[model samples]
Target: MLPYACAWIAKSKGFGKPRREGGFDNHDPRAWLSRLTDWQARANAAQANSFEALPFFIGAVIIAHQLAAQQAVLDILALLFVTLRVIYIAMYVAGLPTVRSAIWALALLVNVGILFLGWR
Candidate 1:
């Protein structure tokens, strides 16, 4: 949600005015979206990635809870996921691709681990 909000703000800030007056503009939405620069672009990308990760994260938590996974472990993993996600957003905005990718992979692994541990 934070990422999405950031993207929305970036988009609005990047494209100052709509060419058309009505709610639906004649200009292509993609054109406006593509106009974002620097951190705004990165914020949009991060927002997309965050949306992509939501399903797996939600599923992992649901399965872990349903399977009676250790409460402490779940809590720790949840904290780690949130922390990593915050760092991930910062890395994305900062243009640190390598570090961002590494953090994304770690977060994915943590989600998988939660699922596996829950199943066990």
Candidate 2:
């Protein structure tokens, strides 16, 4: 959902502007996106990252559940993950790479913590 949100933002921002070879070419979306150099591009990059992060996050949650993690802790961590991701998206789109990287690291740590929630 976060990834899709990023894509939607990118597309919406791209709609009225042409950077090269026209704008938001649905026929060749990848190529069109690759040509972007603004916040739209950042959004696309963030979308890609969000997709990349999904499998790990899903796995972590599943592992936690399978291990019988405390429900409250798991839920809190999941909420924190979403919040951090939203901040990460904003930071990326705003071109704050340094802080964004920190947030990314923090989010990864949260995932790791979630993964170990039921560990003895």
Candidate 3:
């Protein structure tokens, strides 16, 4: 998905404007990377980066469980995390801050739900 986003951006920016054909042009990877980094910054500021907090949340759930874990709970939380992440990223990147913040909250709540359900 990142590659696709980068490729789309490159194409839009006319990385290979004259050719307009195949083969990815190496037009300053850092530039593209910087754009993504900037997006990350925006996302972070907008609270649309809740997905970035999932790993630690999941880790906490795992540790809280310790043993006798339930796969169903994990699966549900994982699905929620991924779904909310995709939505959050799309909305945040598209400059919809309000919607993005709502999505971000939803995703964070999902993580909290996971902790509550999984830890129990």
Candidate 4:
């Protein structure tokens, strides 16, 4: 959802313009996104990273569930992960690399915690 939102925001700017006139090329969305500059480009990169992060997050949740980890704790960690990712995306689009990387690291740790939640 976040990724799509970022893409939409990026593409939205070009809405109503013909693709030949430098409008977003829905026919070649990836190519169009790759050509983006500034915050829009950062947003696209963030979208890619968000997608890259999803599998690990999903796996951690599934693992914790399979191990019967406490739902309350798992839920909190998952929520924190989501919150951090949102911050990360904002930071990315804002060109705050240091802050974004820190948030990314924190989110990764949260995912690790989730993975270990049921490791009694």
Cα TM-score per model: 0.80, 0.93, 0.57, 0.95
For residues 56-86, what per-residue lDDT tens digits would candidate 4 score against the true structure?
Answer: 9999999999999999999999999999999
What is the number of backbone collisions in each predicted candidate, taken in the order shown?
A: 0, 0, 0, 0
TM-score of candidate 2 on Cα atoms, chains taken together = 0.93
- Over all chains combined, what TM-score does candidate 1 have? 0.80
lDDT of 4 at 77: 99
Q: Model 2 off-target regions past 4 Å?
A: 16-21
List the candidate 1 regions with Cα displacement exceeding 4 Å: 12-30
Q: Each model's RMSD to truth, in Å?
A: 3.5, 1.9, 5.7, 1.0
What is the Å distance of residue 75 in model 2 from its true position? 0.1
Better of 1 and 4 by lDDT: 4
Give the per-residue lDDT digits (tens) of candidate 3, residues 7-84. 354344434445334223356644543444444435433342343464667675785476545878767776877687
Q: Which 10-residue window in model 2 sums to the lowest lDDT?
A: 13-22
For candidate 1, the per-residue lDDT at 37 reads 77
CA lDDT of each prediction against the hidden true structure: 0.78, 0.92, 0.58, 0.92
The better candidate by TM-score, 1 or 3, is 1
